[model samples]
Target chain A: MHLRTPLPPRPRPARTTRRPLKHRARVLLLALCTIGATILVSAPSAQAYAPVEIVHTEQVQVGPYHLTVGFSKWPLRAMQSLDFTFAPDGGLTGKSGILSMTGPGMQGGMHMGGPLSRHPRKRDVWGLDVRSLSTAGQWSFTFTINGPHGQGTGTLDNITILAQPGPPLALSWTLCTLPVIGLIAFLVVAWRRHRPSRHLTVVGI
Target chain B: MDSVHAPTLTGPGQPSPPDHPPRPQPAGAAGAYTVLAGTLMSLVGVSWDVQWHVDVGPDTFFTLSHLMLYCGSAIAGIASLVMVLRATFAGRVGRPADPTVGGSPVRVFGGTFTAPLGYLVAGTGAALFLLYGLMDLWWHSLYGFDAVLNSPPHVALFISISLTMVGSVIVFAAARAQRWGRIGLVVSIPVLITFTPITTNAFNGVSPAIDPQLAGTVLFAVCFILMGGITLRRRGVALSIAAVLGVMQLFLWWFSPWAAKAYAAHVGLPLRDNLRHMPPQLPSGIPMFMLAAALVIEALLRLGRRRGWSGRWLPQLTGAVGGVVLSFSMLVQTSMLRGGAGAGPMGPSTTSATTVLTDAILGLAFGALAGYLAARFAVLLHLNAPATDQEGR
Candidate 1:
């Protein structure tokens, strides 16, 4: 039985260091670097300012139309630039819209609304570009859309707004001056440092 | 009480001195002063740009502020380029290097070009800034309206402008013996402020637990104030610089809001930040503190002189004491900026006492360290005697 054993079909390949394993590792490293770079470039932080990209939306349904209202930033704040988008699930081909925005104390009515314009960035939806809500309170947007189906109107109401971001512009500015004021007082006290001296020659330029 | 320079640069094969006294100026002095002027213009543009962003909303590459910045850089860049080319040509023709470039101009591009150290640095910075300016256009093109404020292109532009200003400082520093040279140096003193914005940016990335704005404000305030007092050997120099900076700040105050409001009205764009105005992004109130810090440093120097106190630790010790005042003032500044100046409820009084105390102690410690280094830098740059020179006296 031992004599009848056949020779192996081929000798096992030599196990010296080769290109395939190193090549695969190099590919993996490259892939990892790409992912890391992408993450760094794309990851959102407390940026200087954010671009107008709709990240979240609220829905408003009136008559036969279902509209999605999108905001560039969430948890809306006063005095912030944000894009607002109004999209119909059906598409924008045959539709026309007018939007009227009312402040915290304002009343909503047919006379307050107007035609909605296309968002500069969000081309597919009718919206406003880099618009800001001036005061923190409950606000509303009245949308009027006309299409083949018929005219319909809806109100997206009671949107809550937080206080403005950053410090008080005026007060922070006043506070900034405090240090300078102190510095001035100190200098006035030390004014004698520049008094004319016998050894000091005022060189003429 | 006055004496003229006794030719330290006299060499063989060079022209002999005239019987009449020479004016204390090097050939490259004009270029250096122009560079300073250019830097001033650019600084205004930078501050204006910040205001524009907050008021009129996101901007394009072709905004008025950008134009101002670009134009100012062009002025500086052109001046540096001309000086460099002139020096290179003169060097090629076998002339001696300008004394203002450290008595020897630096050779460049395999000896094809030679330039004064100052102009070379300025030219390089300007060129880099130009490239960054181009890159900014690319960034805008790709990103469209509303790019992040602290984008890579913006950072690069800031660093480049700083480099140009450094070159300007070097030029005046190199020729400190001249009457104009001393004046130029004084004019350039406010340039130290560029550090504040850069360091302040750290607040974005650093943890609130660390309280990074304190570090930026401390080092910037402590080092520059002390260094000015030490090197100029005059209390008034720091005060004058502070006054100049304050005036600029005032102009910015009026100009920023007014311009934003006016521009917005003109363009039909809204200026929503009408209430409380804008929280100034730059070192709005910090430099004014330099007046006080400078006075403190001057007092310390005087005391040290009487007591014969001299050592590496001396500046640090003085800085530590003076830093306390500056540290507290900075807290006020941060409160205003962070809380919307006065409009927000979270003023310094509202913050926890323990936290403010922690920041002050830490800032004082850091200021001590920064003061030492700044003093060293001042001494190094103190190439000429501190003089009371008058223009056209």
Candidate 2:
């Protein structure tokens, strides 16, 4: 049997019973900062303001198909423009094809008037060459204008556009995001919690 | 010499060893608890979906707040009940340490399970949103109401299903291969599915063809149950209790007449003739009272256990508490869902404040009951499984 031996005396520090106010204050400050940061990051996107109106469309018919177009506040002189496309169902498809004037002098004259007419009433007469009309039957064309002002969509009937059977129904992008974010957050927390810790241990001789 | 030998034969006693280190808690376990609470909290949507009424006259009483309070309290109460019971019993019926019972396996598997469930909820929500998208496209294209509900809702359903499938595969692979990337994939799928629907008008099938209100209810419910299931499953038994209470509450919900009464006293029309008729449902206030009772009983039992007060009465008291909560929740859910006198939108408000309040209360109270049931069942199952697992041990 081994005999028990007394070890050398060790110094002990003076202990206080009071709680640490500094620690609490630090936590409070951190929490407030987090809340403030969240609000700042999630605010909505800004939009441009402009005085614009949706004007009626002009219709063109070819064979069994038709086309309708319209625009407003399009500054042809300023080279700022508007454009759009037609789906088989008369809905807007893809992005709008932009309208433009050929040259600087030609552009400024666009808003001045048409030909020798030079009527200010016909000023800013920008033209959009609709690529092609696809769908048959009583088709409709809708114009979506995006410029210095906000965006607006307008529809005019009896215009024929490109026709296809139909596109495959795609999933909504936003709905797919919720789970992705939540799982990421969960995993990050798990990793942090499971991190290795350093410590000292007494060794027996 | 003999006497000295006798003295030498006496050996020294063994000193007790230091207690084992406190067991490690599962990661993100607390967050899981909070998530579960939030899920049940959403059940308040049920009251707003349908109205409540008693067998009595119409316009007797009505308010959605009372319903919400009842649901929230019920969930909390049920959770508390199981918690108290477990804490109290842990000391008395302490079993030998069985690491396999609920240790690493649960912690590991739980973290993996949540991602898929989240994905499922998100996917389902998305599918519903897609349906609305289709409806919008059709309505704009055809200029008819036929595409309203079926079209737009189809989009959301498609989104929800696709996401769920992807998330589930990721989760499964993560489990088999122990991949961390799977977790990210799992979590992302659900978040996207749920958030996407509300972000876009694709899920807005509120046209003449479809009841936007009803579709909204279905989508929200699907979202809650799926997400809630994921959250609860992570916690294992605690969630199981909530599930039990939720299921039982359904029974009561289908049958009970959720009653509420509103009395208006004004001098303009003599005695009580000036009262405006709201509906047939009377706000009975019973759900709230029952919720309070469940909580109090749970607390007292817990306190009693902590004080080392044990008797035949304790178990009986627990039983009674669980029974009452279970029955009340069931009746209320049944009555509200089935469409009694107070069913339908109560004027301007589609979702009433009373509904939110009652749901929170009921969720708590029912959660407590569910917790109690889970604990008891878990214990029983634990005891029974061994007998079947190893013969003649």
Candidate 3:
């Protein structure tokens, strides 16, 4: 009945300790690190050149200062949204600047002029959003900077504005042809169906 | 009730047994109403679609508004196809064509399929619309979205849709001649609606240039005056049509923004940044002067009748008068409500006098042209004569 005393009660296995708080903290830290890495990687890279599609950039000496001005889009279209940026050779800190954009065919004082600020993402670059080209022709943008070092002015000129592109040719032609063909078929069929009957009636009489 | 009338030969020779001629079957109440519904749906759908583009920016081809437009085309196409099939089968079975079936069947494409001329034309338009819808999707993918109104694909689509409108006009003309007066009135609303998009530049309230706006307004006023005036001979009929159209335009002016907002919310689509916080300005104003212009035209028609004047140049005359009135009224209303200038598309405060004078002159010329064309259209569609006087003519 004892059955060998039930083989002397099997030794209890060691229980693993649960580190809930510590485990969670480690996981949370890992997640934060991953997210930080992702954000850092995705952020725009810093470069000496302007970030937008630059038509051209040049170094210009303006009243004892050196500066670079850039246009964002090439062959600008009427009412095209773009950006313009100015970078002083020294730096943007302790500097304030204004941009005045004027173009041909634009009314007097119709120029887009605004103060430049450090781009939020690119701290070294001083820029402003130019909402529209507004007119088509040659545009001249002038930038004036007043810094603790000195005040200076520079111009980016001969920026050509082109007419906005129309719909693509192949697609336009294809779409236009469909209705014309259908209309012709309809008219021709209608005429053919009616013509013989009218002729027969005239002959029978 | 359906009845077949034997063809009457008016020749003086002895009467002989004639071959079985295709019977004339005017589109009955159901067909008339179907076309009317299709047209209204098209108008609503097109207006909504345009607003969706303005408010929501780019969207896929299968948006709700597009579905609505396609549904309209489908309804018209199905109704037309049904009529064609019915007539074809009826004729094959040697039975009298049902007057409720559709209009008389004309053999199309070497007798491959027999269908009424209106239905055939409408069906062709529907097919073209389908083709263009696909082409538009492709075109957008290639060319990017159009910020302006007159893309080539858009123009093609408009032309196709206009063909459907023309078919509806012809169908309603036939129906009205058979005493479907209410249907004619109902159909005219859609006709006017369809015409509105073609003239969006005139009334869209966005452009600051006065010349385009003036031309657009003149064209719209002249075309509509001619359309209503030439089709309807009864006193007040043209005016009533114009009034109804104006009311619809007003409703759309109010409804487009609401519908756009609601649709964006329902689909969880974020509106473009520019439109998000801005209060919606009404897209355009109804041509309120259309009613006044219509009244003047009616008065002229009455005077013409009293004086026994021929109606040959009546449409042109009506158009000229309507154009002047509409342009003047628009100028006054815009100037008063929005300040003397710069407030609307009419332009800056400096050129009000020049704009008004120039617009007035252009409107007169365009109105006359539109009147002439509308009169010709009416004659072509057999809508020139009164419904009662249309028999045998």
Candidate 4:
């Protein structure tokens, strides 16, 4: 018969009186640093002062109307969320407008049209709020304005939208699904590893 | 189980060991306990996601909240996978299936793999959840930026996770012989109860005196309380689950708001104008009458046993009775807390006599439905097949 041996009890640590002020100061400093870092990293990618900075403006003259089409971000990139503003010269009193967009992939120029509404945050001009174009190619914005000055139509054509920012969608999906494949392989290995002795007539059932 | 042969008698004066040995816990085991934890994390994440939508507007594909939600689902999936594969391997070797995996072993892949009913169901739910999650991203890409609760893909996701929670409940119900199993059952019942509540979170905002949304979710919650009694076949199982549920409810009450504000501040986003003065839209609440309803169920269940009642109707009746009691409980709580009568979070109360009556009536209808469904589910979980169905006994 084998003799049983009991495990030795773990020794308790000697109590040390820590400097509360010093410890608290370190913790407070760490917290402040973390807060400051988070604020810096997550600041919204918009100018805080003068929220809409119109980097590029295309002047479209349709009959007597002179319309200024403004883009918040220039060299427009597809899938890049930004603002689009349409400001008719001499302010917007008693003037109503509709904006329609036609892009390269759209067959026969079937326009995506809607009444131009003022941006919720920026009320001075008719605008699209945090919008993104899906395709990276030539696109056009058509504007229709109706007022005492009579109705007029204008188009800002050959507006190039660059390729979407970041890696390809397909590539992202492939990377995401890699773990799924790995999980399947792991399951197969696990099954084989724990499997009991296989003998007799039932072989590999 | 084949691993569990006849009790091993070590030597003279030594006691006979248990029929099955305790398995090691990996990521809190491929077991019921892990499912409980996983479901809770997922619900917390859901609460956070809802709050994020309310306060800060649209989110990208990856948020800290979304990650937490995905992590929860992944844990459940991994746990179910491990259990199923191990069980399948053992069955293929002509070994006895684990006793914890019920008598009616669900064979798959042309009878080659032995799948435990709970794990199979849970694994399938997890797979569906992941698929639906991917679909959610596509949905966002196709139709940009809107925060509606009952979106098609989001609903599909909720249903899948609910399936996982149901499977977790079955896991414990099947393993009632162990102490851990009993405790796990207690914990799991509460987790499952909250599963539907997260779907009704939108109602928590903007002043609805007696939220009609509560009726549907209360039905989901109260039925599970009855399930704790019916499936466990014990006197006080419902009460135990209700007690555990209170702890969860209290934690959520505190954690939901704190997490929402903390994350919003971290992201440097301002709260929307509507939500500037509101409380957190919690995914679930205490369900005010649960404790009382549980005691009622315990009494009725004990009485059923004493009378030697047999067959299916008892659970349904008990659930119906509990449902009514809970509806009234909600009525009392609302009256005391709202209608501009008290300092409740429901905001500038609109509770009228007519509204209260309407809520109670609707509550009654929902309660009956909840009871009827809970009865059938409890029975399904409790089903035991004859020994002839299994091999190498």
Clashing pairs in 4: none
lDDT of 4 by residue, B296-362 (tens): 8788777876786643455566667777778777666555545365566554566678866776675
For candidate 4, what is the TM-score?
A: 0.60
- Model 4, position A155, has a per-residue lDDT of 89
Find the candidate with the highest TM-score and give its number: 3
**Tens-digit lDDT track of model 3 for A85-123:** 577877877777777889975686777766775542244
Q: Give per-model TM-scores.
A: 0.62, 0.23, 0.64, 0.60
TM-score of chain B of each: 0.82, 0.25, 0.80, 0.82
CA lDDT for candidate 1: 0.60
C-alpha DockQ of every model: 0.02, 0.02, 0.04, 0.03
Off by over 4 Å in 4: A1-205, B1-30, B200-212, B274-277, B283-286, B307-313, B333-344, B384-393
Error of 1 at A152 (Å): 21
Give Cα distance to truth, residue B353, candidate 4, Å: 3.5
Rank order (by lDDT, best first) = 4, 1, 3, 2
Retained true contacts (fraction), each candidate: 0.00, 0.00, 0.08, 0.00
Error of 1 at A45 (Å): 28
Model 1: per-residue Cα lDDT over B1-393, one tens digit each: 111122322222233423333245545676777788788778877777777765556465556766688777778887887787777566546575544442235555434456665676677677667656655554443334443444455656776777677667657655655556656766676664643565255246547566665676677667765665555555466566666666666676677667766766776565532234345655364444556665666677678756867554667888887777777766665566557444653332355688678867876797798667666555433322222111212
State which docking tier applies to candidate 4: incorrect
B1-393, model 3: which lDDT tens digit per residue? Answer: 111122221112323323343234444556655755666667677777778766764344566776787778767766766666666566555665432233334554334345655666666666566666666655554443333455566767766776676666655654443446434644454365435446344234455654555566566556755564555445566676776777777777777777887998887655543233322333354455667767876787667667766555666777787778877876766565455545544344443577778778877887787666656554433311122222321
